[model samples]
Target: MANDFPFFKKQSNNWVYTLLLLPLWLVLYLNLQIIADFLIDDLLQLQNGNHLTEALRFFIFETPKVLLLLILIIFLVGIIRSYFTPEKTRKILGNKSLFTGNILASLLGIVTPFCSCSAIPLFLGFVEAGIPLGVTFSFLIAAPMINEVALVLLIGLFGWKVAIIYIGTGLLIAIFAGWILGKLKLERYVADWVYKVQIGQSEEEEKLKFSERIGGGYAAVKEIVGKIWIYILIGIAVGAGAHGYVPEDYLGTLLGRGNWYGVPLAILIGIPMYSNAAGIIPIVSVLIEKGVSLGTALAFMMSVIALSLPEVIILKKVLKWPLIAFFIGIVTSGILVVGFLFNVIM
Candidate 1:
């Protein structure tokens, strides 16, 4: 009975509920500022001029606005991802030219969202599917760094220019880093047990009804938003605190281009940290507003998201320590160059 159930069996009759709620969601989303102002100014009778009041206003406004965006984007991406299963993705990457595979895998990472926690399982799948290590690294790097959630938040909060620069630089790094790693012939560094582990053949994916696709979207919202909402809130809250209390030019003095050690320091501090783009973007926005250089902030953001300690830890399960170190070394070198380049140019 459970196997026979469709994706949205219960929701098949719930279209009216969904349609009715979308307008309400849109109305609330469109007036988030007004709502935040009403709550802070009118309802709470808080004056707008004070730091505490502004902080509260920011927290109230950003929480809902970002949540709404996350729900929408994650849902849409989820539906799109239903078309790209792990088996299919590996098959696509299999038997590809090393250089081309990195490019394709990096692009594919944009649509198929997988986080660091999923890395071990995905690596096992890659092993079973006979996918190249370099291609898998590209996908892993790009997925968390330039994900749709990050792109949407950057575009929505910052603007198109920042978003484009972030995406462009991110793709290039993923492609080249993976390509370099591939050219090094690092397959010998993988764990012997990993290669020996056999997996069953993947069954063909079934075509689904339109409603099923919609169901996939809802599932994505539930899973993704549920996982990262806290990180988003914490990031926004920190941003709000800095926005309210920190003096202008404080961060600039430390992390701005004026400081010779700024960019490398930011990346060094960021590598051990862990957070997705949605969580880190809010902080990055504050950094920029406080006169932090774009390149430095971006380097920090990419290092936190793409080269997180957690990812490295998980990958250690399948990769020897030497390969892991080289992986970090290569990716860090690429990130450092991007950071310095942008700081100089922009």
Candidate 2:
């Protein structure tokens, strides 16, 4: 429908059209709270202090706001990512030393936006490009774990301090994990198919015009938001339930810093679950407010996003069981350490 409209279609490639939409974006972003208040406070008569009502209202309010943020951020990120495809990333890392490549790959993962589902292709691409095993691991770990969606959502919900901690710890995990794997000489564990398969190259890819980049951004919003909106709703729903109804003491005792088991328990629970950062951060916010330790909750959140069961299954095409197990073990140990250290210190 938007494609049929001249103004909307033109916005895809035109800076003027893009600028014109800012007012609309600003209006929607600013007024989501007002709309939530009307629905929860006025229409539903949900008083502020009531737990159930507060939970429902929190869900109602956060769902759209988070979605809106996701759409906008993902749109811009999509544009950024368009410039740094797996092929380009492999090329960039091909010439660097392992230490430098690992560092750069970890940073690139923030902007590249490759999810775990793409692990096989990305691994193959890097290997084919003659990139180092440890550097590849660095990119793989950082790509999903330190993604912009998680960072932005964390900042929005818990403020910059928590977001920064998550980023710093996540990057450290990626860098050291890759470096360790590099030291271990695990290249023999990669699947045979990866070595045999050839990804054919095309003519030099043409650069997209600014307008086309803008169009890519809009396309990204449609694709990403369409896919993840349901997850966002489910996350918000869980968060609301926790916010309004869960007993603070129960949460504190179970996930609070004082409980030695809290960190591992959180990680254990998070592994089987599947959710992106956009879906999980709201729940983290509720948990923290209910007295869950920041480290424990962040650990849980990272496990859900970074080490999901689905991701492991997907990676089976490229990595053998031994290699996968090693990867998981190393990363999990790091996460546990991070949780305990943060819990003890902060």
Error of 2 at 212 (Å): 0.5
Residue 254 error for model 1, in Å? 3.0
TM-score versus the correct structure, for each prediction:
0.85, 0.85
Q: Would you list the C-alpha lDDT of every candidate in the order shown?
A: 0.83, 0.82
Residue-by-residue lDDT tens digits, candidate 2, 17-127: 667777888898899888888998888887778888777778778877877787778878978988887767777889999899889999988887586657777888788
Q: Which 10-residue window in model 2 sums to the lowest lDDT?
A: 1-10
Query: Please, what are the lDDT tens digits per residue for candidate 1 over residues 1-346?
Result: 1123353467564365457768988999999999999999899999878989998898899889878987887877887997877667788998888899999999988887576778888888976676788988888888878887787777766668888988999999999999998889999999889988877767878887666677777877777787778877876777777764545577789999878688889999999999877778877877877878989999999999888778887888899998998889988988899899889998
Among residues 3 or more apart in sequence or in different chains, the pairs in candidate 1 whose N, CA or C atoms overlap within 3 Å are: none
Give me the runs in candidate 2 sitting further than 4 Å from their true place.
Answer: 1-8, 11-13, 27-61, 237-246, 249-251, 282-286
TM for candidate 2 is 0.85
